[model samples]
Target: MKVSFDPDVAMLLRRVAPAGVVWVLLALPSQSVYADDYPCRVALCVPSPTNPWSIAACVPALERLFDDLAHGRGWPTCEGSGVSMNYVNTPFDPCQGGLNEAGPGAWVIEGKKQPNHPTWFYTDPASYGISPSASPQQSAGGDAVANASLACVGKLMGTYRTYVGQYNRDYQEVNVAVYDQIVWQKPQSPWAIDVYQNGQFSRRVHWK
Candidate 1:
């Protein structure tokens, strides 16, 4: 049988293929998927190498994040209790700062998406001083099980990484990171966040 997958899913499968992972396709229902929705039906509409800020759902939060990064603002949070998102340049460090500071790594964004919508978005990453990678090594999970997403893309100028685990029934949060020219290392405790379905996030403790 012929089966298709989201760009993020397809990329994940390729990356995990070396581990001998068996691919299984499950039928999902069409609904308003986001961090704020209950029984969260998250559909990752943004694709890697593209600025998530362009997505209608991700505009608000991502725009805020970009602003914070540009101004050296503290960590940004989502709309929910005990939920926040952090952007760090170094791995495993609570000090969230600009990706240009890290000096080595790639910034990426991985997630699930509605099968009907194409992963590509007409967004400009250059505005954030971020460029696309022909082949990105960093990746994350987007299955319903995780009910979350991640981003680890870019180059020394700005490498990104994050893991958005399910925060609660009301919302979800993401951990975004950027690397420099060195290498990509997983964070010790990726920032925790709680996000609503509308793309709004909360700012909590920063890692600077």
Candidate 2:
């Protein structure tokens, strides 16, 4: 008998190939098979260019996350209470006086969306102790900070996939918007990630 399979299920079977053959055979095809063909959209929220993190760090980290997801490394899970995002804090002087150094700089993975709505995964920044002038010793000149930020992006990517899969299974057009407001120290500039259901990345939109 001929059987139908959703794109995501096909992808999953491909991941575990030979070992998953039996499972794939046993799995039932989606009730609404036509839904998996629709396009999937994604958005990224960016902080103002004035924030060093946005230009010098966050962008690259985000790019890395997208590249990894496109290549298929699987997404991260958001099941616990602790913060799943990472950031690098840099001290900023608002009044131009060094006497009172206020922490107002950070680069982070805000969160992803499910279909057309936002699904926040990283909610507790304070719990992570994000502070300006805080640098990972192992990073040795921003490497550690960048890695941490990338890790956070990776987790966010996982969440994005979960939402995308749901939309695809439902045969609904996927609209994902990632918002970046985790850094209160800088102005927020949102961006987006656009991709088709066939795994084609459309474009990255940077909002003014």
Candidate 3:
């Protein structure tokens, strides 16, 4: 699937992926359309990577919680709790932010129609100050999962050592990083899709 994130989700992903601190009310009234006193959904979304680890580990657990809440999985009492979790993931596992982003990782989430969404990301490494072809990670893809944003992609850039290191040992490290922002027009062509890196547009894709 192909997708894009709202500015709010994109902003949050770029900020928190590097372990930046974000503040929110975290307490909302039991009902919507309430007063300004409504609680906020304060949270962070980052990449999960490892031998068996992932850039999306915490996502499914949170998704399950959403299901639980919607299902009323015997947790109606949990509503409006001081803490609430929100997360998103795609391509199933391995997380594009992880070391093997280009390998065989695809989150496969149902998303809006976009074309050639994955090639820019999985085809190259993220090389700074270089052209897209030179930088493998210059590519980008997004869906409902803003976790698929710049911060997580930063984890992709930091993957240099993984490829250079002997035996190519796994390298899963998320450090401070900055994003420029990726913005694009809704695709004019049915096959074309937008791509963003560092919260900004790196390029667009066309249908085969």
Give Cα-based local distance difference scores for all models: 0.33, 0.28, 0.29
List model 1 lDDT by residue over 119-188, tens digit each: 2431233323344542233233333223222332334233233333345652433333323332233443
- Give the poorly placed runs of model 1, Cα more than 4 Å off: 1-54, 90-208
Per-residue lDDT tens digits of candidate 3, residues 25-85?
2122233322221222212322111111122323333343345645656221122222322
- Candidate closest to the true structure, highest TM-score: 1
Clashes of each: 47, 10, 21
What's the lDDT for residue 195 in model 2? 22
For lDDT, the strongest prediction is 1
- Candidate 1 minimal-lDDT segment of 10 residues: 38-47
Backbone clash total, candidate 2 = 10
Alpha-carbon lDDT of model 2: 0.28
Write one digit per residue (lDDT tens) for candidate 2, span 161-198.
21212544643322221233222222223233322222
